[model samples]
Target chain A: MPSITVKNLSISFPLYHENTRSLRKMTHLFISGRLRQDQHKKILVQSLRDINFTLRQGDKVGLIGQNGAGKTTLLRTMTGIYEPVVGHIRVEGSISTLLDPNAGMNFGLTGRENIYLKCSINGYSKKQTQEIAESVADFSELGAYLDLPVRTYSSGMQLRLGFGLATAIAPQILMMDEWFLTGDAGFIQKATKRIENMVQNSQILVISTHSAETIAKWCNRVLWLDQGFLKMDGTPEEVLPIYLNKPYEEIVKKD
Target chain B: MSDHDPTIVKEPVIDLRSVSLSQNVKLALTDLFQGLIQWRLGWKLALLDIKLRYRGSILGPFWITIIMGAKISTIGILYAYLLHLDLQHYFTYVAISVVLWTYVNGMVNDSCLIFTSSSQLILSQRLPYSIYVWRNVFCNILILLHNLLVIIVVFTIFRIVPYTLYFLLPAAILWLVNSLALGIIFGILGTRFKDIPPIVAGVMQSLFFITPIIWKVSSLHFNSNYVLLNPLYPLFEIVRSPILGENVSASIWIAAIGYSLFLWIAALFIFSKTRFRIPYWM
Candidate 1:
């Protein structure tokens, strides 16, 4: 019964420049007769435009786009981090996002402690965090190393610990930026398997990835973003070929 | 910030609109209480912060007292003489005042950076933004609790048993309401304005001298009327006066309560409207 309804969503961020960030400079400008009322202008970058989508249980969607095509913006928008301008988003379940694997895990705290810390921020109660502590430790394969600070862990080890917690949270909706965070060969293989299972089992999965083959293999549906607009929305089978053929930029170049 | 049940009980779980005053109040209260109800999370995060700050040190959060002790005793000796007050009574006044002042000081200073420091957590996860604010307030409170040990040792040495130690509870609640309101306003403003945190630091530096933490207010025969207008003065009085076995001044209590109410309303208006902008700003 989990669902997400995003209607005509758009997002933009005000871009601040060097001079604009300094209140002192701005005030000085005002006093020195260097600043006119119209001189103070705010610049905004529209990252997403009129995006509309519905995700019910058992929807596996791939968000495909170029560098600035608003893929990550859309994911963050759903998380309620960035409020949409002129749109409504009604998410009917708890959400877990893998925007950054290392985002919440404290480097200074021991892995076990960080599990509690990370899970707490992820909205787990202390008792719930305790319940999952064992499983998280086991899944990470950090063993006694879990007692050591995360700063002591190798980069790969840190990634494992992060991935373990991200998957273990088990929220109804799972959103990831790059589908999988690749490390060395062995670690990436293990991570891929774990993520595949987690993503498959989650009630809804929306991932942004550059891997067309992976999209073809995994996604039931695909969304292609051209700049801020939703250019194409259909099954991966229907949209992937068209996306691969035109690539948005080349179409813009022809125009 | 409010978590709805996963079951589809309603058609629209969230509404999108420009922040209205009533809706803003509801959002602010819901977020505030959500963080309060999850006090465990805030407390744990506070502990982690304290542990990390004092890692590899024997003293841990005792550093708070060590610094306060050094500052208070040094100032207590000189100021007691200058103000023509007894050393024991003066030291006691200075000790309690400093602890309370540090709590407000640290809370105000730390509040601005709460969102910026936790930008990673805010972006990657969706929890109540108030949780981070609470964690910071709780961390400062934890430090205050540690520094309160300084007050106990100081009190015992002076053989001055506390008259209304229990009153500190309600006093602490009042202090929290004030701090939470200020913290939210500053957190939101700090997120939007890069200049705010350092500017706050400078303002606080100046305000510390103006607010009578080290210097006794009663001892100040001149400029006392203007000092009465300082909102921070009543804030210090409510907590410190009780422990000193003095009746809480109605003027001070009224000023502090009115200030807190005004701030809460203003903070809510700002917070609810700008809450979503925080992540983007950060």
Candidate 2:
């Protein structure tokens, strides 16, 4: 019953002069509220423009592009993270997105505590979260380290914990930036197997990764974007060969 | 990564549906209410926030209570002597005043951080935006409850038992409501401007001294009534005066209720108009 339909969806980020990277200028702008918006030039980054796609149940979508080609922005929009400024997205399913590992953690909390925190954020009950916590801890294999603060864990250890907790839920729509497999070769193999199984069972899977090999293996469809424009949409066999033929730099020319 | 790749693939395959304006307003109200209505999500995050904040310290949040007790005792003796008031009555007044002031101050200052600090969770997860605001307000309330123990100990020392205890509930309830509404607005405005949190902190610092927080309203020879014109003065008096067993002012109750209604409307309006813009701003 899960379906994703996006039509003429254009999302442009508005960057005001006062809200720029400089702290000193922002302080001046803060003190001077009388200044009008038109007093300074406005800049808007057109992250996604006129993107149209319909993804039915069981569609494994592999999103491809160079850095800042709106791949991450597109995935984020589907989960309702970034709203489309011009168009609209209609998604009929419960979406579970693993966009970035860094944003969803409190390092002061233990691994087990983080697991419960994430579960509750997903709107799970306490008893349900407790059960999910057990599986997450087991899959992460942090063992007694789950009791210690997650700050003590290495970056690799943190990634494993994030992967374990995010993939535990059986979602109608699953979105991820990359295939989060880390640690030893044995652990990588185990993670790959788990991801494959989830992709098989889930109603839809949308992954944005650079590797053509992973797309060929996991995806039936490919969405290629450049400078916020949807350039190509086709089977991996048709698109991947053409997409990979060019170097990344030439393809990533800014608009 | 496809510069040479043709922009045209196929003619549009998906239906383009126009989103109505009403849907946005509905979504905004949902964002605000969802954070409050979903008590489970709010409380869990709040408890975790408070726990993590005091994790390593020995006395934890009780440390606030100890520091507050010392401040009250020292300030009570000095201010009462300086102002020519009875020692016991003035100490009790300062104790209740400062405790309630801490709660208000904590709510205002911490509210600015609700959305900015939780930008990570907001960017990755599909949560009702106001959940972070609720967590902030709830966390401060938890600290307020802890500080109430100091009040009980003070009451025991003064041997002033409360016969009109029920009168304090409405004032306390109004205070909590104000904090929740004001906190959400602060969270939204604070997120967009990026510099608002520090500016707000500076403003609050000045407000503490300007407002009749350390001294009584009657202590002012001139502008004593004008001092009550400060919104904070009425808010502070509503809760603090009730605890001190003073006569409740009808005008104070009216001003507090009227101001609270205005804040709720303004907060909801700004929140609904700007909720979608949060991701872009972040």
Candidate 3:
């Protein structure tokens, strides 16, 4: 029953450079009765413009876009990280986002403590926390390293901990960014298997990636964004060829 | 094992829209109430903050006690000598005043950084914004608890008994309420205006000297009633006089309560108008 609905969503970020962020300038503008005039000069980067879409159960949607094309913004918006300026987004399920693996990890805390902290942040009960700790400990294979501060761990070890903790709890809606896929062969295999399990259980999955093969492999639908606009929304067979400037059969065949 | 109940009753909905005052108030109230209900998380975070700050050190949180002790002793002895005041009474008065002042001053100065310091957690999670404010308040209270040892030693040395210690419960609660109000006001302003932290620091610097922390208010020749005009005066008097076993006038209590009420109103006004913009400002 998980679903996402967006209506005329337009998001713009007000660029607060030194000029606009200063209280002195703001106060001066207010006293001079020039606040309205200065408001006209405030810079706003329209990250997403008039984007409209609906995602429902069983839809594995891949967001394809170039750099700064609002894919990440759209995902973040859906997660309620950023408030929309023009319209609304209605989400009907619990969401877990892997936009950044280390988003909430405290380096000063031990690996086990970080796991507990994440569990507590998510409002997990004590028994559930203990279960998650055991599961992450088993999956990460860190052993004694779990007792040490995360700062002492090597980057690869940190990745294992972060990845394990993030995927420990599967939500109704799973959203991810592409960079999470990078790692050694063995780790990548394990990570992919876990993600696949999560995807299978999730009511809806949305991933933003640059790889056409990723879309062809996992997604049932494709959403192509260009310069903050949703340029195309349909099945991969209909949009991938034009998006990649290659035939759809070749992309899937190579994968 | 990953099974979830597909039949979600009252599924959460986020209906975002343009900034409207009424909607902002509703959201702000909900956020504040949510944070209050999750005091456990804030309490745990506060404990962790204290633990991590002195993780590698031997004394751990005792460091707070040592620093405060050193400061109070140096000021107490020097000022008692310069003013030709009785050492026992002066030291005792200075002890309570300094401890109370530390809590107030720390809360005010640190309030500005509550939101800015936790910008990472703020952006990544969609929890109530007031949780950060509570975390900060709790952290300061923990430090104040550590500093209590210094007060206990001073009272023991002077052979002075705090008979009205029960009054401290209400006084402490008032301080807690005021700290939260300051936290919300300054937390939002500090995150929005980059200059707020420094400006707040500078204002607190002058206020410390102006407030009767190191000096005694009785030493003033002018009408002592004028000091009550300084909102901080009544707050300090309520906590300090009660500890000294002196009667606090009903007027002081009224002023203290009145100031806190005004502060909360202002805090709510600013917080409601600007709570949503905090993430973007960061």
Tens-digit lDDT track of model 3 for B182-226? 999998888887788899889888988998888888899999888
Model 3 CA deviation exceeding 4 Å by range: A18-41, B1-5, B8-10
Q: Against the unseen true structure, what C-alpha lDDT does each candidate score?
A: 0.80, 0.79, 0.86
Worst 10 residues of 1 chain A by lDDT: A31-40
Score residue B212 of candidate 1 by CA lDDT.
Answer: 89
Winner by DockQ between candidate 3 and candidate 1: 3
Worst 10 residues of 2 chain A by lDDT: A32-41
- The docking category that best describes candidate 3 is medium
lDDT of 2 by residue, A208-230 (tens): 98877678678999999976789
- Clash pairs, candidate 2, are A65-B1, A66-B1
* For model 2 chain B, the run of ten residues with the poorest summed lDDT: B7-16
- lDDT (Cα, 0-100) at A96 in candidate 1: 79
Instruction: Sort candidate 1 into its docking category.
Output: acceptable
For each candidate, report its DockQ versus the true two-chain complex. 0.41, 0.31, 0.57
Q: Candidate 3, after superposition: displacement of residue B56 in Å? A: 1.2
RMSD of 1: 5.8
TM-score attained by model 2? 0.89
